[model samples]
Each structure stands twice: as structure tokens, then as C-alpha cells.
Target chain A: MSGKSRRDFLKSTALIGAGVTGLTTTAKAGPQNILSEDRMGVLVDTTVCVGCRNCEWACKDAHNLPAGNLEDYEDRKVLDTKRRPGTDALTVVNEYSHGKNSSLPIDVKVQCMHCDHPACVSACIVGAFTKHENGTVTWDTDMCIGCRYCMAACPFQVPAFEYDKALNPMIMKCDFCFDRTKEGKLPACVEICPVEALTYGKRSDLIKIARDRIKRNPDKYVDHILGETEVGGTSWMYLASKDFAELEFPKLGKNPAPGVSESIQHGIFAYFVPPISLYALLGGIMWITKRRKELDEEVK
Target chain B: MKKFLALILVLVFTIGINAQQSPGKDHSKLNLSCKTCHSCDVPTKSDPCLVICPREKITTVYQKPEQTPELITINQLSDRYGPVYFSHKIHAQMSIMSGGCENCHHHNTSGPILKCNSCHETSRKREDVSIPDLKGAYHRQCMDCHREWSHETGCNSCHTLKKDLKDTKNESLQKKYSGKDHPVIIEPTKLVYETKSDKGKLVTFYHDDHTKKFGLNCTSCHKQESCTKCHDVNNTDKSKNQKVVTKKTFEDQHSNCISCHSKTENCSKCHGEKTLEPFDHGKKTGWALNKHHINLSCAKCHGSKLPYNKLDNKCLSCHKGWNAENFKHSITGLQLDEMHSELSCEDCHTDGNFGIKPSCDGCHDDYSFPKQKPGKLVK
Candidate 1:
């Protein structure tokens, strides 16, 4: 390739890269292409959960991990402290006592939120993460460069890096059992829930169901349905007897994560105007300087 | 077109045959439309679409507490927990005091009372999402009361560890509860509420009078009352007050009584400075229930919630069977002569009113009730 042409190509590539990064995120809320119309979701009525932790056992078994003795999952002593999803365990049930007086503590299962416009997918520079049609945010290990940008960008702090491994490392999080679902099977946790605290259905239908539940049981449930609109929307929703804030769920607005940044990105890369304008200004300066130099040479 | 015609002809013939072959159910007499039970226009054997029994209304299965299975082993989807030794009889008895068999068997159309797994799926991941799963149904039923009374979420309360299933602690508890009757709650005769209202400081309730005298069933006023209403051990004064968060008005508290009693008139009747005594039949009605009437309920004769004015204190008004033939004349401490015995009860008892003094003029200027004797008195 000629030098001039190569320089032009590099300049255009950098401009395109800047535009792609810019268009990745915004604070504005709206419908996005990431979530399909009938994307499946899980409605978690935390009020119905009995903190049995059978789901934890099923999750480990499905992932080909050692689940320990299945009977030991019922010990419930491990719930003494709050825990998050980790490499060892894809899902963990945490027991949160509402207040000092409440005898019954609420159990919340921690996993990936799988946002409609996932911040992980947005932050992954290599385009490794993908939002599946089944509402699962999955990532390909081969494409990942061990950047761990997804872990930093995740609002829920879900993704765990296998830093202990000196060999090939992998990011760990709940995949929503995408492979199992694709093969006409239910997600491991959802299939094993005895009390049906976790309800699986279309994401649209789940929102309606959550709303209907709150409407029918005014006294039994708080009005809010978490993930219905928070961070644009998520595949996993929650309904609780107490306020979600008291349960330690992060408060979020009804804005698509990629709204503001995408706008700035589009504006800078619109019809190659930014790069072309820069080149034109540089060309004008070079022309003036070259003319001055020629004039000085002639005067000499 | 020919195939369609043949199909219609077959359908008509089938309908005709069905009508002719059907036994005497008297469908016409029942005045039931075809859609009453069937959900389809043409109910076929393949997809009959039989309408689901309405579950909103509690359909009672006629099961006495004693007739029900006393114990049930709940080991449907458990590996870690042992089969729960459910004390069914005790719970059934408790259910009667609160709601009836319909409390648990709310959708029981007929036949045996259905188990939770009969309708509810054992697993959560199923096609139908309307009804809860077996575990959900169990917990929902139990927690409705346990939440209010025990306030416990401990699985050990209902479930024992599989490893310790043979432990004496669990085994003894299972044996103690299974096949045993629940302790009967001795219903209080009277209750007094210290109303915080300015109009009525105290309200005295005659609980036994409503049961024995008024003939009201336990369920009439106690509908939807869980065991927690009375048995909540954790409900101390501060908690009890806090639990009654749904602010009820003064009239709302008195709503149950207002259905029969005057709500606006005579506030002092129920609202007294002190707790009042139960209503005495003799003191209130000027006629005490003697030996024969003592055990009988007021509705046995009244048969209606009418005012006392609607009932006249006539002997035959209630004693319809006290005719001349059926009446045990000897029980009156007298065996009448053959002639007098053959006569009707009204013959000597002039107005046929036993309360009134009898005249003898009806038979041979016969013996009056007090002055003269009809025959040798047989005690």
C-alpha cells in the first residue's frame, strides 16, 4: 500500500474506533435491539422463597462442579453471612433480616442480572460478550483478552475472573443456562425451585405477572417490581415484601446504559465529517506554511 | 363438498343416537343449557373441553374431622429432609374451629378431599403457571397461620433432617402428634373489650349466649380467623397494637352485631361502664327453661331470628306432639279413667291451654283440675 493511502486508512480506522466506543453507552432509557420481543426471563418473588438452597445444589450439578453432599445444602448455617456469586458457586442465596424485630429474614439469590443492554457487552473491547435472543448475556472465551473490563462495568458486580489460574483463565458468571434452554430444558435453578419462588416466562409476560401480583396483594408486597425498568430492563426481575432498597439492591434509573455514549459516538463519526474536517484544516495550514517557505527562498 | 355432507350426516346421526341411548337423567327437567358444563359448541370425546369446576367459591367436601386421614408423609421432592410426619387430624380439627373442611379442601367438588399435589405441580417448571407447586401450596397454607402465630420460618418446625429421622426427638414428636385429636378450645362464655372510643369505653360480649341461645355456629363470626387471633404467643401489647395496622372505625368493630342488633339506637345496651352478665332466659323472658327446655336451643322452637313478640307463650305452640293420644297422661301424676282417657286433651282443659285451670264441665260435669279428680291419681 502507498504511504499516503495507508495514512488515510489508519486515520479513518481510528475515527471509526472512537465512534464505536462513543456509541456504546448512554444514560437515556428506551427500547433497544439487544432484547428480543419474546425474550425469556425469571420473575423472582422473594417473599415465597424459603431459603432452602436446593437451587445452589442444582446449579453446581448442572455446571459439572462438585456440589458436595446434597443433604449438606440444607444446613442453612452458611447463610449466617451474605455472599455473592463466585467461580466456585454460580449462584448464592443470601439471608437478609429486614430489621432487628423481624423474625423471618428475606432470602435473595445472587446471580447475573443479564441486562437488556448489558454493560459487560458494552465494555468488552474485543466484542466477546453477546446478548442472546433468550435474554442470556454470554461471552466467548477465545475472543476475550483477559481485560476484565466487563467486571468493572457490571453494575451488579457479577462477573468473577479466575485470577488464581496461571494457565488459560475464564470469566465466571451465571449464563442463565443458555445451552440447557436451547436444548429444550429449563434453567437449572428454575427447574429445581420447589416453592416456585422463581417464575420463568417471557420477559414481557413476567412484568405483567409481577404487576398483577402486586395489584392483587397490596398488603403482601411492596409496589415496586425490580428490573422492570431499572437500567432499561433486565431478564431477571424481583418482587419483595419489603422495600428493595432495604434489601440492599442498588437503586437505578430507567435509562438504557448505552444511550448517552452512543449519541456522542454517532455525532463524532457522522458521514466521516470529523476526520475530513481535521484533514482539511491540516491541509490548509500546510499549504500556507509551504507557500511562506517558498517566498522566503525566492527572497533569498 | 361430498365429504363435508357425509361428515354432517354422521354428526346428526351420532347426535340422534346419543339422545336415544342416554338413560333417564332428565336433562330437560334440570333446565341446564349445554354450555353449563361443556366449554365447547360441539363437545367431542377427543377434546370435550369440560369446564373447570369454579374454585373461587369454596366447595365443601362432606368430611368430618374424625373421618379424615390422621397422618400424611410428605416426602415428595425432598432428599435432605426426612418425610414430614404431618399431624393431619389435629390440623383438621383446628381447621374446623377456624374454617371448615373447605379451609384446606376449598376446591373439593366431591369425592375424597384432594391433596395439594392433586392440582398443584410438584415442580415449578411446568406449563401451567396458575396454581402454585406442591411445596408452594404447603408453605402458603402453613405460613398463613404460622406467620401470624409462631412467626417462624425454621424448616425444622415441620421438617426433620433425614440423617436424624430416627432420632428420639423427632420420632417422639411425630408419634405424639399423629393419629391424635387436637386439644379442644374451651369457648369463652363472655368477653369484654376495652374500647378506646369516647362513645363506648367498654363492650361486653356474651359468647355462649350467641352459641347456645342464638344458635349461631362457630364459623358465623369467626370466618377467616387464623389460630393467631388468640394463640399468638409472640403478640405482646406493643406488637398486638402494631399488628392491627388496618385502622378500623368504631362502627366497623360493631359491624357484626349491627346485622341483627340496632347499631345507632341505645348505645348503652352493649357499651357499659363495666362488663355485664350473660342474658338469663328466666330473667329476660319472664319464663325460665325448665327440665325439658333447659337443654334445647332457642331456635328449636323459634326457628327464626324474630322478636320475642312474634312468639306467643302457648303450650301447644311448641308442644305440637302433645295430642290426647300421644300425651303421656300418666306423667301428669294421674291415670285417668277409661272414659276420661278416651276424651281429647281439650275436653277437660277447657281452652286447650294447659297453663290455664281446667274445667270439668266438658265431661259429666266432671272433676275440675284442682277441686275434683278424674280417676285414682297415679304418681
Candidate 2:
């Protein structure tokens, strides 16, 4: 075959292969949003957090990250204090003391709640952030340009940035492990928690569970579901001994975080429309170029 | 120069012929010219490069070197399609085990076919759109092979997605081979040398124990990342040999330690803080702190680390400069040595301030301590 014919044949074969494969795709029925609408979240019961830092260790282990200095709990006296969730610390349990009268100080485990209307998703200009159907607001650091807007937008101050990485800085937060979720597993924190302070389940199911726990022991927990209404809902909920405010949880606005920014993003970039239009425009331009080339050839 | 040029031309022709052939060709038979392309005579090397490099080393690869994959432009897609853990060795063995290779052989008359990417390429675009470009190529090959194995063998046949998948099942296999003892020591990584001897009273520092039992939060000494809080240059008083600021005479380390330990849920473990240090009752370390213990909680006094077993039972132990000898009981007009030695001082002298009158008659003779004789008063 002539070289041109050979090339064309290969191209055609490739296209045919694509068409064939496209036809064979196991067409999954339903809303096609198996991942969407499945809102995933974390229910952190601070009252149950023994402050063992098992979740921290488990998290590092899951990510294959370096072991923190508190690898051994013996002679490990740091838990005597309160701490904030930091770069390495996606979640931290801070001990808030309300004197001796208020039933011994409880350690509040703080991490990204993976909100229903994630502010991080809106703040991410490059679309590095996404809220999975299971309600996990995860980030792709590879796409991240290291802007800390998500940190600011988050009412709970969830997303933290790695300031140490000068060249390829990234925003670190609890992903709820979207990768693990796709494979049908619980988040690392939930999986490793010996004491079920961090429980992973379907968001709706978890809400009911939280309500049941509160109803069963009326005096033990406050009546409200923390993530049920906080900051347009978070996948990771909280069941506390006292008022949520006493645990230093922020009183968030009613509207979901992504409302304003997502609309703007859709308005300006128009979701799938812009990309689709761009593809069409490119096809048109290519056709015009080929036509013009043919015309020039005819003239010659 | 002309001979060299002719040689170059022949080399170019050979290279062009080789390039036209599909990838995964027998490398030994191939003869090529590097100069034909590098010499800048040819416009470009139209043939694409095989993406054989490990994913860790190279973040992305072009489907066609000239035409960059559009999906790669969507940075999230690269993250979505993280590297597949393909064990080439295992797959090769599996292929051989499955009736000497015709089962998976491609290219018409192949005996044994290897290299998965040979058939699987970006050409196989799926409808999901989400599984477009290179991802579809990977998924079809991997998932199809895995699905086939699942039917033929067991679930782990190809879907050995987890590292521990095989070992977990092997437990049952081990039971089947009962009575045959094959002791196996699966060493993960060998240590080159012994850094520390296993001699002496080695403290079994259960790093995993405290963390496992108490959880990461049970640790009271370290920061969130587990770095020892006291030793982290920033927290400790460097001048004091990095000793915890709260720690003074070991007693202080004991006392304040409880106050600190009381924060976490597991309080009784450390708050009832006991140390293994030997204590001598003789060398009275004296009650450590000042007048603070009088009004303070007993936890503060007994809780803090003092010199082990040191006691100060006498008045002078805590109350220095006060004359325990010459200080008379002015309330009852009694001398210190006369009436207060055998009698408990608290019986008369209730308050520590020494202002309250502690006279026997004050309680017994309700009217007056000094009896005004009734006869003299009547006159």
C-alpha cells in the first residue's frame, strides 16, 4: 500500500476500533449518577474520640506517608494539650476544657467534613476539587495551583495548605478517600478508628443513625444533627456532649457553600457547553483550512 | 563525504521501514539510523514513542508524541487515572499456565503474545466519556482479563486489587495441608546490622501499644504529627536540658502531668500518675511548694512529682522561719513545750493564722475562762 493509504487505513481502523469499543461499553442504567446523589460524609463523635491518634496513624499509613513523631503513645504526652488540624494533620483532636463541672474536657476531632455544597469545589479554579455523590469533597493536588481560597471559603476551616512545599505546593485536607470510595471501602479515618468516633456510612443513613443515638440517650447528646444543617451540610457530621458551639464549631450560614461561585463558574464557563462549543469550533476551523488548501491546490 | 552520505541514505531508508512497522517488534532484527532524524533533514519523527517508563517516573505520556492527548489537558483526568499496579511477572506466568498462550494471543498466528498495550490503545474509546482516551485503553485490558479470571478461577484471579488478597485465602490452603509442618519466616526487609544489643533491662517501649490502645490522642507529650512536644526545641526550655517546663523536681512532672493528662478521655491512666523511680523515706525532700497546698486540692500536692517518698511530717517541713520550738500558744497563755507537745495543737489552735483563742474554758466554761468567784462578785 502507498504510505498515505497505509496511514489512512490505520486511522480508519483506529476510528472503527473506537466505535466498536464504544458500542460494547456495559451501559449502566439508572440516573448514571451512581457517584453523584450518593452524598458520602463522616460522622465524628468527639465524645467517643479517645484521642489515641490512631486515626492520624492510620491516615498516614493509608497514604504511605511518614510516621509522625507520636508513633508510640508511651511517653507520648502531647495529647494532654489541644491542637489544630495542620498540614500533616488532616484531622486533629483538640481538648476543650469547660472546667471540671462540664463532664471532663472532650477531644474534638477536626478534619474536612466533605460538605454537600463544598466551598473547596467552588474555590478551585482548575477544577481540582469535586464533591463525589457520597459527599466527599476531594482534591487533585496534581491539578492544584496551591491557591488557599478553599481554606478561606470553608466555614469549618477544613482545607489546609502545605507551606513547606515551595515548588509544588498543595492544599491538604481529608478526601474521605474518593479512590477508596470508588472501590467500595470506608474512609481511612473511619476504618482505623478502634473506638467508633469516626463512622462512615451513607449520608442519609448516618443522619438517621445520629438521630437514633441522640434519641436513645437523650441526655448524652444534643438534639440537633451537626452536619444535617451546618454550612449547607457536610458529609462528616458530629455528635457532641454539649452544644456544638461549646465544642468550638462555627455557626455557619444557611446557604450551601458552592451556590454563588458555582453559578458564576457555570455562567462564565458554562459547564459542558464551552468545551462542546470549542470542539465544534475546532472542527469547523479544520474543515475551513482543508477547504482552503484544496482551493489553492486547484488553482495551482 | 559522498560514501558517508550514501550510507546515511541507506540507514534512513532502513529506519523509515522499521518505523512503519507496529510497536512490540523483535528489537534484534531492527537496524536504524539516529542521524536521519537528528541531522534535521527529516521534519520530525512521526512515529510515537512507547510509554514503557514507570508511571512514578513519568507523570504522563503522549498517545502520539506529536498530538498531545486532549484528556491529559484536563489535569484532574491524570489524577483520576493513577498508575495501575500491573505485575508483569505474574501476568506472564498466568498466561503460560493457561494452555501455552493461544488464549490471549493476538496478531493472527501468535503462539505466545505479551505486552498488553499492543492491542489496547487510545483507539478503543468507550461511551462513558469519563473512560475516554488512555484510561479506556487501560480499563478494557485490565478489567476484561480480571473478569475472565474471576469466572475461570476465583475472585482474586485478576481482581487481586488488595495486596493481602492472596495471603488471606492461603490460610485455608494451609489447613488443607495439615500435619506437614513448613515453618516459613516471611521477612519483609532484612536489617544489615544490629544497632542495639537485646541485653540489659530493655524497656519494651510499645510505640504501637500506647497508640493502638489509647489511640493517637492518648499521647499527651507529642504534637499532632507526633513529634515530642517537650523536646521540639520550640517547646522546651533549651537552657534546662530540654526538660519539660512543667517538670521541676520530678514531683512537678508528676503533678502538672495529671492536670495535662486530665484533658483526654482516658484520664485515670496518667492522672493517678505513678513513677517507677525508687524512693527513700529518710532524705525528706520537704513538701515542694509553698503555702499553696493549704487551700489547694490534694491532687495538686500528691499529684505532682516530688522527690520519691520524701516526707515533712513536722510543722517545719512546710512552715520555715516559724519558730516551732519557741512559738508559744498565746491563745491559752500556754508555752509551746508545756501544754502543746502531747495535746494535739488543732484541738485548741484551730486556724493556721494563730488568731483564734484556743482555751479549754472557752468551750467547757461557756461563761468565762477566768472564773470570777461568785462570792466576790456578789459583794
DockQ of each: 0.21, 0.01
The alpha-carbon deviation from the true structure for residue A151 of candidate 1, after best TM-score superposition, in angstroms, is 6.7
What value of lDDT does candidate 2 attain over all alpha carbons? 0.52
RMSD of 1: 11.0
List A-chain TM-scores for all predictions: 0.78, 0.71
Q: In candidate 2, what are the lDDT values of residues B43-76, reduced to their tens digit?
A: 2347343334343433122112122211111112
Q: Which stretches of candidate 2 lie over 4 Å from their true place?
A: A1-37, A68-71, A74-76, A98-103, A261-300, B1-379
The digit string of per-residue lDDT tens for model 1 on A1-300 reads: 565787799899999998776676442233245668889899988988877787898999999878987667867688898898998899999988855225466889889989998889988999899898889999998998889998987878899998898988989899999989999888999887756788888898888888889998998799999999988899999999888988778888888666556667888899999989999999999999999999999999
Per-residue CA lDDT of model 1 for B84-149, tens digit only, reads 767777787788767777887766645344567878887676766656778778767776566546
What are the iRMS values of all candidates?
A: 4.0, 20.7
Clashing pairs in 1: A23-A262, A25-A258, A25-A261, A26-A258, A26-A259, A26-A260, A29-A256
By summed lDDT, the worst window of 10 consecutive residues in model 2 chain B runs over B68-77
Q: What range of 10 consecutive residues in model 1 chain A has the weakest lDDT sum? A: A25-34
Local error of candidate 1 at residue A241 (angstroms): 5.0
User: Considering only the true interface residues, what is the Cα RMSD of candidate 1 after superposition?
Assistant: 4.0
